[model samples]
Target: MASGGSKSVASILLALNLVLYLVITVIASWAVNHGVDRSRETASRLPIPARIFPIYFPIGNNMATGFFIIFSLIAGVVGATTSLTGLHNLSQWNAPNLNAAAVSSFTTWALTVLAMGFACKEIELGWTDSNLRTLEIFTIIVTATQMLCTGVIHVGVSEAPSITY
Candidate 1:
Protein backbone atom coordinates (compact mmCIF):
# COMPACT_ATOMS: atom_id res chain seq x y z
CA MET A 1 0.00 0.00 0.00
CA ALA A 2 1.08 3.50 -0.64
CA SER A 3 1.97 5.89 2.19
CA GLY A 4 0.00 8.89 3.46
CA GLY A 5 2.02 11.27 1.35
CA SER A 6 1.18 9.36 -1.79
CA LYS A 7 -2.49 9.37 -0.93
CA SER A 8 -2.38 13.12 -0.36
CA VAL A 9 -0.70 13.69 -3.69
CA ALA A 10 -3.34 11.61 -5.42
CA SER A 11 -6.07 13.62 -3.75
CA ILE A 12 -4.45 16.87 -4.80
CA LEU A 13 -4.11 15.70 -8.38
CA LEU A 14 -7.75 14.70 -8.46
CA ALA A 15 -8.76 18.14 -7.23
CA LEU A 16 -6.60 19.82 -9.84
CA ASN A 17 -8.15 17.66 -12.56
CA LEU A 18 -11.60 18.78 -11.47
CA VAL A 19 -10.60 22.44 -11.62
CA LEU A 20 -9.10 22.01 -15.05
CA TYR A 21 -12.25 20.29 -16.26
CA LEU A 22 -14.30 23.28 -15.19
CA VAL A 23 -11.93 25.60 -17.01
CA ILE A 24 -12.25 23.56 -20.18
CA THR A 25 -16.01 23.59 -19.95
CA VAL A 26 -16.07 27.38 -19.58
CA ILE A 27 -13.67 27.95 -22.46
CA ALA A 28 -15.54 25.61 -24.77
CA SER A 29 -18.86 27.19 -23.94
CA TRP A 30 -17.44 30.64 -24.62
CA ALA A 31 -16.09 29.53 -27.97
CA VAL A 32 -19.41 27.98 -28.97
CA ASN A 33 -21.26 31.13 -28.02
CA HIS A 34 -18.76 33.27 -29.87
CA GLY A 35 -19.14 31.14 -32.97
CA VAL A 36 -22.92 31.33 -32.85
CA ASP A 37 -22.83 35.10 -32.42
CA ARG A 38 -20.54 35.49 -35.38
CA SER A 39 -22.82 33.33 -37.52
CA ARG A 40 -25.83 35.40 -36.52
CA GLU A 41 -24.05 38.65 -37.34
CA THR A 42 -23.03 37.36 -40.76
CA ALA A 43 -26.51 36.06 -41.45
CA SER A 44 -28.03 39.40 -40.62
CA ARG A 45 -25.75 41.11 -43.11
CA LEU A 46 -26.85 38.84 -45.99
CA PRO A 47 -29.04 40.15 -48.87
CA ILE A 48 -32.83 39.85 -48.47
CA PRO A 49 -33.38 36.92 -50.88
CA ALA A 50 -30.48 34.91 -49.44
CA ARG A 51 -31.69 35.55 -45.91
CA ILE A 52 -35.35 34.75 -46.71
CA PHE A 53 -34.66 31.17 -47.83
CA PRO A 54 -31.26 29.98 -46.71
CA ILE A 55 -30.09 26.87 -48.55
CA TYR A 56 -27.78 25.66 -45.79
CA PHE A 57 -27.06 26.34 -42.14
CA PRO A 58 -24.14 28.64 -41.56
CA ILE A 59 -22.43 26.57 -38.85
CA GLY A 60 -19.20 27.68 -40.54
CA ASN A 61 -17.24 24.66 -39.28
CA ASN A 62 -17.32 21.18 -40.76
CA MET A 63 -18.95 18.02 -39.40
CA ALA A 64 -16.16 17.37 -36.91
CA THR A 65 -16.86 20.69 -35.20
CA GLY A 66 -20.31 19.48 -34.25
CA PHE A 67 -18.84 16.24 -32.94
CA PHE A 68 -16.25 18.12 -30.92
CA ILE A 69 -18.90 20.32 -29.29
CA ILE A 70 -21.02 17.33 -28.36
CA PHE A 71 -18.15 15.28 -26.92
CA SER A 72 -16.68 18.12 -24.90
CA LEU A 73 -19.97 18.66 -23.06
CA ILE A 74 -20.26 14.95 -22.36
CA ALA A 75 -16.67 14.80 -21.09
CA GLY A 76 -17.31 17.70 -18.72
CA VAL A 77 -20.12 15.86 -16.94
CA VAL A 78 -18.20 12.60 -16.71
CA GLY A 79 -15.06 14.31 -15.44
CA ALA A 80 -17.03 16.21 -12.79
CA THR A 81 -18.68 13.04 -11.53
CA THR A 82 -15.37 11.19 -11.49
CA SER A 83 -13.74 13.95 -9.49
CA LEU A 84 -16.55 13.91 -6.95
CA THR A 85 -16.23 10.14 -6.57
CA GLY A 86 -12.47 10.41 -6.22
CA LEU A 87 -12.86 13.00 -3.47
CA HIS A 88 -15.32 10.74 -1.66
CA ASN A 89 -12.86 7.89 -1.84
CA LEU A 90 -10.14 10.11 -0.48
CA SER A 91 -12.36 10.97 2.47
CA GLN A 92 -12.54 7.26 3.20
CA TRP A 93 -8.95 6.66 2.20
CA ASN A 94 -8.39 3.82 4.64
CA ALA A 95 -11.23 1.68 3.34
CA PRO A 96 -10.59 -1.29 1.05
CA ASN A 97 -13.16 0.00 -1.45
CA LEU A 98 -10.87 1.39 -4.13
CA ASN A 99 -12.44 -0.32 -7.13
CA ALA A 100 -15.23 2.18 -7.72
CA ALA A 101 -12.94 5.18 -7.52
CA ALA A 102 -10.37 3.57 -9.76
CA VAL A 103 -13.01 2.66 -12.30
CA SER A 104 -14.45 6.15 -12.35
CA SER A 105 -11.03 7.71 -12.81
CA PHE A 106 -10.23 5.37 -15.66
CA THR A 107 -13.54 6.14 -17.32
CA THR A 108 -12.97 9.86 -17.01
CA TRP A 109 -9.51 9.51 -18.48
CA ALA A 110 -10.91 7.66 -21.47
CA LEU A 111 -13.66 10.22 -22.05
CA THR A 112 -11.20 13.10 -21.77
CA VAL A 113 -8.93 11.47 -24.30
CA LEU A 114 -11.83 10.92 -26.65
CA ALA A 115 -12.81 14.56 -26.31
CA MET A 116 -9.26 15.56 -27.15
CA GLY A 117 -9.45 13.45 -30.28
CA PHE A 118 -12.67 15.17 -31.27
CA ALA A 119 -11.02 18.52 -30.71
CA CYS A 120 -8.14 17.52 -32.94
CA LYS A 121 -10.47 16.33 -35.67
CA GLU A 122 -12.38 19.58 -35.47
CA ILE A 123 -9.13 21.52 -35.82
CA GLU A 124 -8.14 19.38 -38.76
CA LEU A 125 -11.49 20.23 -40.36
CA GLY A 126 -10.67 23.94 -40.11
CA TRP A 127 -12.07 24.93 -36.69
CA THR A 128 -8.72 26.40 -35.66
CA ASP A 129 -8.59 29.07 -32.97
CA SER A 130 -6.70 29.93 -29.81
CA ASN A 131 -9.55 28.82 -27.57
CA LEU A 132 -10.01 25.44 -29.25
CA ARG A 133 -6.27 24.80 -29.21
CA THR A 134 -6.06 25.64 -25.51
CA LEU A 135 -8.98 23.36 -24.72
CA GLU A 136 -7.37 20.48 -26.57
CA ILE A 137 -4.03 20.89 -24.81
CA PHE A 138 -5.60 21.26 -21.37
CA THR A 139 -7.79 18.22 -21.88
CA ILE A 140 -4.73 16.11 -22.63
CA ILE A 141 -2.91 17.36 -19.55
CA VAL A 142 -5.90 16.74 -17.28
CA THR A 143 -6.34 13.21 -18.62
CA ALA A 144 -2.73 12.40 -17.79
CA THR A 145 -3.10 13.70 -14.23
CA GLN A 146 -6.33 11.76 -13.73
CA MET A 147 -4.72 8.51 -14.86
CA LEU A 148 -1.78 9.02 -12.52
CA CYS A 149 -4.02 9.77 -9.57
CA THR A 150 -6.09 6.68 -10.27
CA GLY A 151 -2.95 4.56 -10.20
CA VAL A 152 -1.86 6.12 -6.93
CA ILE A 153 -5.25 5.51 -5.32
CA HIS A 154 -5.24 1.88 -6.42
CA VAL A 155 -1.83 1.39 -4.87
CA GLY A 156 -2.79 3.14 -1.65
CA VAL A 157 -5.87 1.07 -0.88
CA SER A 158 -5.71 -2.35 0.71
CA GLU A 159 -7.08 -5.31 -1.19
CA ALA A 160 -10.73 -6.23 -0.80
CA PRO A 161 -11.44 -8.82 1.87
CA SER A 162 -11.90 -12.38 0.71
CA ILE A 163 -14.30 -14.93 2.21
CA THR A 164 -12.71 -17.66 4.29
CA TYR A 165 -13.83 -21.18 5.03
Candidate 2:
Protein backbone atom coordinates (compact mmCIF):
# COMPACT_ATOMS: atom_id res chain seq x y z
CA MET A 1 0.00 0.00 0.00
CA ALA A 2 1.09 3.56 -0.71
CA SER A 3 1.48 6.30 1.87
CA GLY A 4 -0.98 9.17 2.04
CA GLY A 5 1.12 11.48 -0.16
CA SER A 6 1.77 8.80 -2.80
CA LYS A 7 -1.88 7.81 -2.87
CA SER A 8 -3.01 11.40 -3.28
CA VAL A 9 -0.58 12.02 -6.13
CA ALA A 10 -1.54 8.80 -7.87
CA SER A 11 -5.21 9.60 -7.52
CA ILE A 12 -4.80 13.03 -9.09
CA LEU A 13 -2.76 11.65 -11.96
CA LEU A 14 -5.23 8.84 -12.61
CA ALA A 15 -8.13 11.28 -12.64
CA LEU A 16 -6.32 13.42 -15.18
CA ASN A 17 -5.70 10.38 -17.36
CA LEU A 18 -9.36 9.43 -17.15
CA VAL A 19 -10.53 12.88 -18.22
CA LEU A 20 -8.09 12.96 -21.13
CA TYR A 21 -9.28 9.57 -22.26
CA LEU A 22 -12.88 10.74 -22.33
CA VAL A 23 -11.90 13.78 -24.37
CA ILE A 24 -9.95 11.67 -26.84
CA THR A 25 -12.88 9.30 -27.25
CA VAL A 26 -15.32 12.11 -27.97
CA ILE A 27 -12.99 13.71 -30.50
CA ALA A 28 -12.38 10.37 -32.21
CA SER A 29 -16.10 9.67 -32.50
CA TRP A 30 -16.56 13.03 -34.18
CA ALA A 31 -13.69 12.33 -36.57
CA VAL A 32 -15.08 8.89 -37.47
CA ASN A 33 -18.55 10.24 -38.21
CA HIS A 34 -17.12 13.07 -40.25
CA GLY A 35 -14.88 10.72 -42.18
CA VAL A 36 -17.78 8.44 -42.99
CA ASP A 37 -19.82 11.30 -44.39
CA ARG A 38 -16.89 12.62 -46.37
CA SER A 39 -16.00 9.18 -47.69
CA ARG A 40 -19.53 8.61 -48.93
CA GLU A 41 -19.55 11.93 -50.70
CA THR A 42 -16.18 11.27 -52.29
CA ALA A 43 -17.09 7.74 -53.28
CA SER A 44 -20.15 8.96 -55.14
CA ARG A 45 -17.93 11.20 -57.26
CA LEU A 46 -15.37 8.53 -58.13
CA PRO A 47 -15.36 6.88 -61.55
CA ILE A 48 -16.37 3.24 -61.86
CA PRO A 49 -12.86 2.20 -62.77
CA ALA A 50 -11.33 3.99 -59.79
CA ARG A 51 -13.90 2.45 -57.49
CA ILE A 52 -13.24 -1.01 -58.87
CA PHE A 53 -9.47 -0.74 -58.52
CA PRO A 54 -8.33 -1.39 -54.96
CA ILE A 55 -5.14 0.57 -55.50
CA TYR A 56 -7.00 3.71 -56.46
CA PHE A 57 -9.58 3.43 -53.69
CA PRO A 58 -9.24 5.70 -50.68
CA ILE A 59 -8.87 2.85 -48.24
CA GLY A 60 -6.11 4.57 -46.29
CA ASN A 61 -8.54 7.20 -45.08
CA ASN A 62 -11.01 4.56 -43.97
CA MET A 63 -8.30 2.55 -42.26
CA ALA A 64 -6.92 5.56 -40.43
CA THR A 65 -10.40 6.59 -39.36
CA GLY A 66 -11.04 3.11 -38.03
CA PHE A 67 -7.75 3.12 -36.17
CA PHE A 68 -8.55 6.42 -34.55
CA ILE A 69 -11.93 5.25 -33.41
CA ILE A 70 -10.73 1.89 -32.14
CA PHE A 71 -7.74 3.26 -30.27
CA SER A 72 -9.79 6.01 -28.77
CA LEU A 73 -12.24 3.50 -27.38
CA ILE A 74 -9.37 1.42 -26.04
CA ALA A 75 -7.81 4.44 -24.33
CA GLY A 76 -11.10 5.33 -22.71
CA VAL A 77 -11.68 1.84 -21.40
CA VAL A 78 -8.15 1.52 -20.04
CA GLY A 79 -8.37 4.89 -18.38
CA ALA A 80 -11.66 4.04 -16.75
CA THR A 81 -10.37 0.73 -15.46
CA THR A 82 -7.16 2.31 -14.17
CA SER A 83 -9.05 5.05 -12.40
CA LEU A 84 -11.45 2.60 -10.82
CA THR A 85 -8.60 0.39 -9.68
CA GLY A 86 -6.77 3.36 -8.20
CA LEU A 87 -9.91 4.37 -6.34
CA HIS A 88 -10.30 0.88 -4.93
CA ASN A 89 -6.70 0.84 -3.76
CA LEU A 90 -7.02 4.26 -2.19
CA SER A 91 -10.13 3.22 -0.34
CA GLN A 92 -8.34 0.24 1.15
CA TRP A 93 -5.02 2.08 1.84
CA ASN A 94 -3.42 -1.30 2.55
CA ALA A 95 -0.85 -0.87 -0.28
CA PRO A 96 -0.47 -4.53 -1.25
CA ASN A 97 -1.69 -3.75 -4.77
CA LEU A 98 0.59 -0.79 -5.45
CA ASN A 99 2.60 -2.78 -7.95
CA ALA A 100 -0.56 -3.67 -9.80
CA ALA A 101 -1.51 -0.02 -9.91
CA ALA A 102 1.91 0.87 -11.28
CA VAL A 103 1.60 -1.81 -13.91
CA SER A 104 -1.81 -0.46 -14.93
CA SER A 105 -0.37 3.03 -15.34
CA PHE A 106 2.47 1.71 -17.45
CA THR A 107 0.02 -0.14 -19.65
CA THR A 108 -2.01 3.01 -20.16
CA TRP A 109 1.11 4.95 -21.14
CA ALA A 110 2.13 2.28 -23.64
CA LEU A 111 -1.27 2.23 -25.26
CA THR A 112 -1.32 6.00 -25.48
CA VAL A 113 2.07 5.99 -27.17
CA LEU A 114 0.86 3.37 -29.64
CA ALA A 115 -2.19 5.44 -30.47
CA MET A 116 -0.02 8.53 -30.93
CA GLY A 117 2.25 6.70 -33.33
CA PHE A 118 -0.65 5.62 -35.48
CA ALA A 119 -2.12 9.09 -35.44
CA CYS A 120 1.24 10.60 -36.42
CA LYS A 121 1.60 8.19 -39.34
CA GLU A 122 -1.84 9.11 -40.61
CA ILE A 123 -1.04 12.80 -40.24
CA GLU A 124 2.19 12.36 -42.13
CA LEU A 125 0.38 10.65 -45.00
CA GLY A 126 -2.10 13.53 -45.19
CA TRP A 127 -4.96 11.07 -45.59
CA THR A 128 -7.20 12.61 -42.95
CA ASP A 129 -9.67 15.42 -43.52
CA SER A 130 -9.00 18.85 -42.05
CA ASN A 131 -11.53 18.47 -39.25
CA LEU A 132 -10.36 14.96 -38.54
CA ARG A 133 -6.78 16.07 -38.57
CA THR A 134 -7.47 18.86 -36.13
CA LEU A 135 -9.30 16.53 -33.81
CA GLU A 136 -6.52 13.98 -34.14
CA ILE A 137 -3.91 16.54 -33.24
CA PHE A 138 -5.97 17.39 -30.21
CA THR A 139 -6.22 13.72 -29.39
CA ILE A 140 -2.48 13.38 -29.68
CA ILE A 141 -1.95 16.22 -27.26
CA VAL A 142 -4.42 14.75 -24.82
CA THR A 143 -2.82 11.33 -25.13
CA ALA A 144 0.57 12.84 -24.43
CA THR A 145 -0.78 14.44 -21.30
CA GLN A 146 -2.34 11.20 -20.20
CA MET A 147 0.90 9.37 -20.83
CA LEU A 148 2.80 11.85 -18.69
CA CYS A 149 0.32 11.49 -15.85
CA THR A 150 0.57 7.73 -15.99
CA GLY A 151 4.33 7.98 -15.77
CA VAL A 152 3.94 10.04 -12.65
CA ILE A 153 1.54 7.55 -11.12
CA HIS A 154 3.86 4.68 -11.94
CA VAL A 155 6.79 6.43 -10.32
CA GLY A 156 4.84 7.29 -7.21
CA VAL A 157 3.45 3.79 -6.72
CA SER A 158 6.55 1.83 -7.75
CA GLU A 159 8.72 3.01 -4.85
CA ALA A 160 7.07 0.50 -2.53
CA PRO A 161 9.38 -2.49 -1.83
CA SER A 162 7.08 -5.46 -1.65
CA ILE A 163 9.23 -7.63 -3.92
CA THR A 164 12.12 -9.65 -2.51
CA TYR A 165 14.32 -8.54 -5.39
Candidate 3:
Protein backbone atom coordinates (compact mmCIF):
# COMPACT_ATOMS: atom_id res chain seq x y z
CA MET A 1 0.00 0.00 0.00
CA ALA A 2 1.04 3.59 -0.55
CA SER A 3 1.82 6.06 2.21
CA GLY A 4 -1.17 7.64 3.94
CA GLY A 5 -0.36 11.18 2.87
CA SER A 6 0.04 10.28 -0.81
CA LYS A 7 -3.19 8.34 -0.81
CA SER A 8 -5.07 11.23 0.74
CA VAL A 9 -3.57 13.70 -1.69
CA ALA A 10 -4.54 11.53 -4.65
CA SER A 11 -8.07 11.14 -3.32
CA ILE A 12 -8.55 14.86 -2.87
CA LEU A 13 -7.17 15.64 -6.31
CA LEU A 14 -9.32 12.97 -7.93
CA ALA A 15 -12.46 14.34 -6.31
CA LEU A 16 -11.59 17.88 -7.36
CA ASN A 17 -10.92 16.75 -10.94
CA LEU A 18 -14.19 14.85 -11.10
CA VAL A 19 -16.18 17.91 -10.15
CA LEU A 20 -14.26 20.18 -12.53
CA TYR A 21 -14.60 17.75 -15.42
CA LEU A 22 -18.33 17.44 -14.84
CA VAL A 23 -18.68 21.19 -14.94
CA ILE A 24 -16.65 21.37 -18.14
CA THR A 25 -18.88 18.71 -19.67
CA VAL A 26 -22.04 20.58 -18.76
CA ILE A 27 -20.77 23.94 -20.00
CA ALA A 28 -19.37 22.57 -23.24
CA SER A 29 -22.63 20.74 -23.94
CA TRP A 30 -24.56 23.93 -23.36
CA ALA A 31 -22.29 25.82 -25.76
CA VAL A 32 -22.79 23.22 -28.47
CA ASN A 33 -26.53 23.20 -28.01
CA HIS A 34 -26.69 26.97 -28.01
CA GLY A 35 -24.75 27.10 -31.26
CA VAL A 36 -26.94 24.50 -32.90
CA ASP A 37 -30.18 26.16 -31.82
CA ARG A 38 -29.07 29.48 -33.33
CA SER A 39 -27.25 28.03 -36.34
CA ARG A 40 -29.67 29.22 -39.00
CA GLU A 41 -29.70 32.77 -37.74
CA THR A 42 -25.96 32.70 -37.12
CA ALA A 43 -25.22 31.26 -40.55
CA SER A 44 -27.01 34.08 -42.28
CA ARG A 45 -24.78 36.65 -40.56
CA LEU A 46 -21.47 34.81 -41.00
CA PRO A 47 -18.95 35.88 -43.64
CA ILE A 48 -18.46 33.74 -46.75
CA PRO A 49 -15.19 32.35 -45.38
CA ALA A 50 -16.81 31.32 -42.12
CA ARG A 51 -19.79 29.80 -43.90
CA ILE A 52 -17.56 27.16 -45.48
CA PHE A 53 -17.29 25.29 -42.19
CA PRO A 54 -19.90 22.65 -41.36
CA ILE A 55 -20.13 23.41 -37.63
CA TYR A 56 -20.56 27.10 -36.98
CA PHE A 57 -20.18 28.65 -33.57
CA PRO A 58 -21.69 32.16 -33.49
CA ILE A 59 -19.36 33.51 -30.83
CA GLY A 60 -15.64 34.03 -30.34
CA ASN A 61 -13.19 33.29 -33.13
CA ASN A 62 -15.48 30.82 -34.83
CA MET A 63 -12.89 28.19 -35.77
CA ALA A 64 -10.97 28.36 -32.51
CA THR A 65 -14.15 28.33 -30.43
CA GLY A 66 -15.50 25.32 -32.30
CA PHE A 67 -12.30 23.36 -31.80
CA PHE A 68 -12.11 24.47 -28.20
CA ILE A 69 -15.66 23.29 -27.54
CA ILE A 70 -15.11 19.91 -29.19
CA PHE A 71 -11.81 19.24 -27.43
CA SER A 72 -13.14 20.50 -24.09
CA LEU A 73 -16.06 18.09 -24.29
CA ILE A 74 -13.74 15.19 -25.13
CA ALA A 75 -11.32 16.06 -22.36
CA GLY A 76 -14.15 16.52 -19.87
CA VAL A 77 -15.56 13.03 -20.47
CA VAL A 78 -12.11 11.39 -20.36
CA GLY A 79 -11.10 13.29 -17.24
CA ALA A 80 -14.30 12.22 -15.44
CA THR A 81 -13.65 8.58 -16.37
CA THR A 82 -10.05 8.85 -15.21
CA SER A 83 -11.18 10.30 -11.89
CA LEU A 84 -13.54 7.34 -11.38
CA THR A 85 -10.74 4.87 -12.13
CA GLY A 86 -8.48 6.78 -9.78
CA LEU A 87 -11.06 6.46 -7.00
CA HIS A 88 -11.20 2.71 -7.56
CA ASN A 89 -7.41 2.51 -7.46
CA LEU A 90 -7.32 4.46 -4.23
CA SER A 91 -9.53 1.83 -2.65
CA GLN A 92 -7.40 -1.04 -3.96
CA TRP A 93 -3.94 0.51 -3.42
CA ASN A 94 -2.18 -2.28 -5.26
CA ALA A 95 0.43 -2.27 -8.02
CA PRO A 96 -1.86 -3.14 -10.92
CA ASN A 97 -4.57 -0.75 -9.85
CA LEU A 98 -2.10 2.07 -9.39
CA ASN A 99 -0.59 1.45 -12.80
CA ALA A 100 -3.97 1.56 -14.49
CA ALA A 101 -4.94 4.74 -12.71
CA ALA A 102 -1.66 6.38 -13.50
CA VAL A 103 -2.02 5.64 -17.22
CA SER A 104 -5.57 6.97 -17.35
CA SER A 105 -4.68 10.08 -15.40
CA PHE A 106 -1.75 10.84 -17.68
CA THR A 107 -3.95 10.44 -20.76
CA THR A 108 -6.54 12.73 -19.24
CA TRP A 109 -3.88 15.32 -18.53
CA ALA A 110 -2.71 15.22 -22.13
CA LEU A 111 -6.24 15.66 -23.40
CA THR A 112 -6.80 18.54 -21.01
CA VAL A 113 -3.61 20.17 -22.25
CA LEU A 114 -4.85 19.87 -25.82
CA ALA A 115 -8.13 21.49 -24.83
CA MET A 116 -6.27 24.21 -22.99
CA GLY A 117 -4.35 25.07 -26.12
CA PHE A 118 -7.62 25.68 -27.91
CA ALA A 119 -8.87 27.69 -24.97
CA CYS A 120 -5.79 29.88 -25.20
CA LYS A 121 -6.38 30.39 -28.87
CA GLU A 122 -10.01 31.28 -28.20
CA ILE A 123 -8.94 33.76 -25.58
CA GLU A 124 -6.42 35.34 -27.93
CA LEU A 125 -9.01 35.63 -30.68
CA GLY A 126 -11.46 37.25 -28.22
CA TRP A 127 -15.23 37.92 -28.45
CA THR A 128 -16.48 34.96 -26.39
CA ASP A 129 -19.78 34.72 -24.50
CA SER A 130 -19.85 34.35 -20.74
CA ASN A 131 -20.46 30.61 -20.97
CA LEU A 132 -17.59 30.16 -23.40
CA ARG A 133 -15.30 32.15 -21.15
CA THR A 134 -16.35 30.00 -18.23
CA LEU A 135 -15.61 26.86 -20.21
CA GLU A 136 -12.16 28.20 -21.13
CA ILE A 137 -11.31 28.99 -17.53
CA PHE A 138 -12.47 25.57 -16.39
CA THR A 139 -10.45 23.86 -19.09
CA ILE A 140 -7.32 25.75 -18.10
CA ILE A 141 -7.87 24.91 -14.44
CA VAL A 142 -8.54 21.23 -15.21
CA THR A 143 -5.34 21.02 -17.22
CA ALA A 144 -3.31 21.99 -14.19
CA THR A 145 -5.33 19.85 -11.78
CA GLN A 146 -5.10 16.80 -14.01
CA MET A 147 -1.33 17.17 -14.21
CA LEU A 148 -1.11 17.40 -10.44
CA CYS A 149 -3.27 14.32 -10.02
CA THR A 150 -1.11 12.37 -12.45
CA GLY A 151 2.03 13.40 -10.62
CA VAL A 152 0.62 12.47 -7.23
CA ILE A 153 -0.47 9.05 -8.48
CA HIS A 154 2.94 8.42 -10.02
CA VAL A 155 4.69 9.40 -6.82
CA GLY A 156 2.41 7.12 -4.80
CA VAL A 157 3.15 4.18 -7.07
CA SER A 158 6.89 4.75 -6.71
CA GLU A 159 6.78 5.23 -2.95
CA ALA A 160 4.62 2.17 -2.30
CA PRO A 161 6.48 -0.80 -0.81
CA SER A 162 6.99 -3.75 -3.10
CA ILE A 163 5.13 -6.92 -2.22
CA THR A 164 6.38 -10.35 -3.23
CA TYR A 165 4.61 -13.71 -2.97
Which candidate number maximizes TM-score?
Answer: 3
Poorest 10 consecutive residues by lDDT, candidate 3: 54-63
Cα RMSD, each candidate:
5.0, 4.7, 1.8
- TM for every model, in the order presented, reads 0.73, 0.67, 0.92
Candidate lDDT (C-alpha), each: 0.71, 0.64, 0.88
lDDT pick, better of 1 and 3: 3
Winner by TM-score between candidate 3 and candidate 2:
3
What ranges in model 2 sit over 4 Å off? 34-63, 127-130, 159-165
The clash tally of candidate 1 reads: 0
How do the residues 30-95 of candidate 1 rate in per-residue lDDT, one tens digit apiece? Answer: 766765666566568777764553321245345465456656767877787788778887776654
Q: What is candidate 3's lDDT per residue for 1-165, written digit by digit as tens?
A: 447889999999999999999999999998888888877887887789777787678766558888889889999999998898899988888777888899999999999999999999988887788889999999999899889989999998887656788
lDDT of 2 by residue, 27-145 (tens): 66665555566565566777786454332213345445566556766776676677778667655544367656667767877777777777787787766666567656756876776
Off by over 4 Å in 1: 35-61, 123-127, 158-165
Give me the displacement of residue 58 in model 2, in angstroms: 8.3
